[model samples]
Target: MANTTDDTTLALDAVKGEHPTDIFSLDGEGDWSPHITESNLPTKIIWSPTMGFSTVDKDVLAICEEAISELEKAGVEVVVNDSIWEVNPVESWMVFWACARARAQQHLIGTEEYESIDPLLRLFIEMGVTMDGASYASAIDACHHYNYQLEEAFQESPLIITPATCGQPPKLEGDGFVNGEETASWVDFTMGINMTRNPAGVIPVGNLDNNLPVAIQIIGQQRADLDVLKAMKAFEEVINFRERAEDF
Candidate 1:
């Protein structure tokens, strides 16, 4: 967890001039405190333990830390706690299977034409081909679980910031696909939003030492899509992110 320190540090340094657009304390709301704003940056960040993985590369953590720190120092409120609920493993698979099934149905009905598709995608279609009643029940359960968690988190804070990806962009292979494990890592920071059906967006903030882009994700409650976009637009004005990129 501490491994993200360096990358996050550099990332903050990269976007030195940005400032907060609005500052408000969540003190009276729930179990969270407004004073977390005064603590060291990471201590103020809230991540879900249910989203655990085997290993997070040092650089991945670094970028994450940097983004959080910069946002905090600029006067945005941050919360360090388990603020969201967890979904069952079966529920997670059911969502994926449902999406795959739709894709397979599209292909079967000849909606579009392509010379070929990725082998993994083909496998996904096959997996979804047999979706049953149990699958539908699991999907509904997952929807409710995610909506509840999102509602709980939003009750504490209006905005949630997270790493856009687990780490830097992957080096695409000749087959145009990374291994299953690596691809999974890339989506670590994102798939939860998909499953939860929340509105989220990615804003490019800085670059890694190797010139790879680093982005921070902004997420909000369901049906608050416009509010989420407005927040990002305000952030864009404060960070003036494109000007920073031009400097690079």
Candidate 2:
């Protein structure tokens, strides 16, 4: 995910010359690892000026930056923490669950008919444990661990901000939308926090030459949801996100 969009999806859009780089030869992960500086904060917050910001949800990033500064003034360190996603245990379980669901024509997040409660259809039903029976305790516990980290680290921050999508908006694909688009790509930026039950909201940013939305998702740490949201409200009243992102 060079930025955020899935490699397969990027390659699909690349065929039409809509992507910034040649996607066909992309290896997904040779380099491009996210890293932080001596301050232990990201040296480069991933942003693709070419892809630009979302014309529809641009206020988010500005509000987050503003909130960070305000929080700092009050003696707090506000940062967009780099997700230690590669080492996350829930991620592995999520993959297994996702694959199991896919085999039964079900999807974990994107599809309209997500069989979560009662789980009328799927392997879990055959084994009799859809939402929370017995076998899933391992996976659920792992998810809990993931959330605990968010609770401990992010709960103090006034607000957290992330791109709506890592790269740019995705384009239409061939015969079926499956390969070209997946819910994961669309949610690359903010879903991890969402998974931990953090409060999050997206605001219109700006757009690319292709007229795609490049919104920023604003997240709140745990129960501080209201303050985080209100902070964004304050920042939105003062900042000019579009003017600054003209070259985004």
Candidate 1 residue spans exceeding 4 A from truth = 1-56, 82-115, 174-181, 238-240, 243-248
lDDT of 1 at 118: 57
lDDT of 1 by residue, 105-170 (tens): 546533334226555655566667656667767776776776676677766666676666655576
State the lDDT of candidate 2 residue by residue for 109-215, as single tens digits: 34454555445345443432244444456666666776676555444444555555544444464221112433333434443554566666554445555554445
Q: What is the lDDT of residue 224 in candidate 2?
A: 46
lDDT for each candidate structure: 0.54, 0.43
The TM-score of candidate 1 is: 0.63
TM-score per model over all chains: 0.63, 0.45
